[model samples]
Target: MSRRRFTIRRPRGVAEYGAAALVAAAAVSLVVRLLVWVGEVLVRWWPVVAVLALLGIAVGAWRAAAAAREHTARAQRLSVLRFTLAEIDAMDDRQFEFALRDLLIRDGWSARQVGQQGDQAADVIAGHPTYGRIVVQAKHTKVAAKVGSQVMYQVKGTAGPVHRANSAVVVTNGSFTRDAREWGDRHTIGWADRERLRSWAELGVPLHQILQLPTLARRRLPGTRQPFPAPYERTAPEGRTNGVR
Candidate 1:
């Protein structure tokens, strides 16, 4: 048996064939010249090129690692915030009020709880730097339930005559209605909306750390009574995916 040989066919026209061969030869020659030039450059400046290449690789790797770490940290913070939000929603009225008041105190306010009887709809009274005495009404609700105009009216009315507050603030673990927000904007009422609450939850030893495990108690360090686990474990809430979407 004879083996058939494969061959590349050329253009039949003489000028066309010559042009194609010349183009192909030129491309090959250019590639050869580029390779020779690269080799010569490398041989002449190998030390500098090697150092620069290593430096470039190191920089690229470092930047990539830094970006990845930042992304991971951001994801962890978001997770913690979401869990804290769910925990806030899970809180009862009194718990929610106290937490909000505590957050106020963390921000350098002399916050007091006044949500009991005769409190006049004011859950917290805070000494603001600018507003002097400010009142906050807390509403911890489902994400979809918006704080309506009635709540705003109560906020204004109770804060004005009853508490003699300088600023009436409406804080919610959820969101605010358009009318409620509009009224607040018009009346110079401060609002700690869900995003603000979420930001608060990201603070040191935040509500995420205070959350009860299945036993309705804070997850404590194994050897000690500390609510936080090891530093790494503290970054993520354990066994809870039912957080904000």
Candidate 2:
């Protein structure tokens, strides 16, 4: 059975107004009495209340400021990630190498590009303050293309030895195949995939700054090659006329 409940309607004239005003007055009186009680309490324990209140305010302000700073940092990182992804997507192979070198310099490295017609195409050579010297192999591939094991091996074998590098890294705008990544990991050769590269650009977190490989941090001993041998002045890669990408 369907049933409709009847609602009692309140008069919409002076009676409603009078009832509302009475309720309002009673509410105000209750609030006033509460405030009076608080005032009396405060008179007795004002020192304790003041100290607690001030401490609470300070803690709240510090937390709010910290949260605001963290929020701003996250927003800035997201903005940079967007711009970096766009640039990486558009850059050609040569542009990618030189750009990587520039990024290394910005993140506190003496960086240069290895320009050669045939040398396994080892891209950039840079020196890290903490990690010493490291050779780079840059691969600017389409997003879907996965860097394979053969290329990973070539760079792993060549980049470090050819330049007398303490360690080697392969930088890619595309991702690596599982086999390639595993091979590199086993050999202590590092790589930066697309998303990782974006974080590097966005957060100013350069690779050379973070690796914990004992060999990477210790090489370039007293008489050996300088951590940063003559940083080749920055320049566009050879045969670049069409501009970026």
Candidate 3:
């Protein structure tokens, strides 16, 4: 048997070159038609595309501005004020309550002054997203005149049942009587005398840290009823509109 071999050859002349040119021209024509269709479509819908792009940019800018404002407000709230003990002492009772309410707001609580006649021992009601609700009693008095245990008695009796407070505190610009301190300790009520108040108002110590209260597990005491649904007063300062969660 004889083995046969085959050889491949390139196109020889004009006929072959003309066929190749026809294929290339067809390809170019197809590409040009496709590009023309795309360009017409883009020209016809250019206004809509531009509007969508502008909308996207406006939405992104709005979100970024909102985030920046939130950050700035948070920083302003966290910044410590230059408060002095003399300033605190000079404040009237109502002014003192408002000052403490502002301090609570600075410390990230939605707080307002409620100290008035028939306030039920709650001078301030504050709510935190993490720590729940707290009631504060403010006493503005001279250093020589000390806050007594009666303040603690009043707070312990009414803070939970009347105001639905998770924690109760009495803050004073004067010293606390020994009996007052003991009473607050016994009942788990927090008392901040002049020095402690200075630390909180001036040094930016958070009230929760000073009170030593737990953050999570916002549970009521055994046999205690649920907190009142309408704990916040209608007049929330700084445009806060809602009650405690």
Candidate 2 clash pair list: none
Kindly list the per-residue Cα lDDT of model 1 for residues 1-245, writing each as its tens digit.
99999997768898988999999999999999999999999999999999999999999999999979756755655553333777787877777776666665544456666687777778877654333566778888888788888888877777768766666777788898888888877876767678877766543333222321012232332345533211211111234332334
Off by over 4 Å in 2: 1-83, 209-225, 237-245
Question: Cα lDDT of all candidates, in order?
Answer: 0.66, 0.73, 0.78
Which residue window of length 10 is worst by lDDT in model 3?
236-245
For TM-score, candidate 1 versus 2, the one ahead is: 2
- lDDT (tens digit, per residue) of candidate 2 on 11-117: 59998989988988999999999999999999999999999999999999999999797677556534432236677688878788777777676656788888467
The number of residue pairs in model 2 that clash at the backbone is 0
lDDT of candidate 3 over 1-245, digit per residue (tens): 99988985666799998888898899999999999998997799999888998999999999999979766754554454435688677777877787787788667777777788999998888877678789999988887789999889999999989887788899998899899999899898999999898877766667787888777555553454743223444344343322122
Candidate 2 lDDT score at position 55 = 100
TM, every model: 0.49, 0.59, 0.58
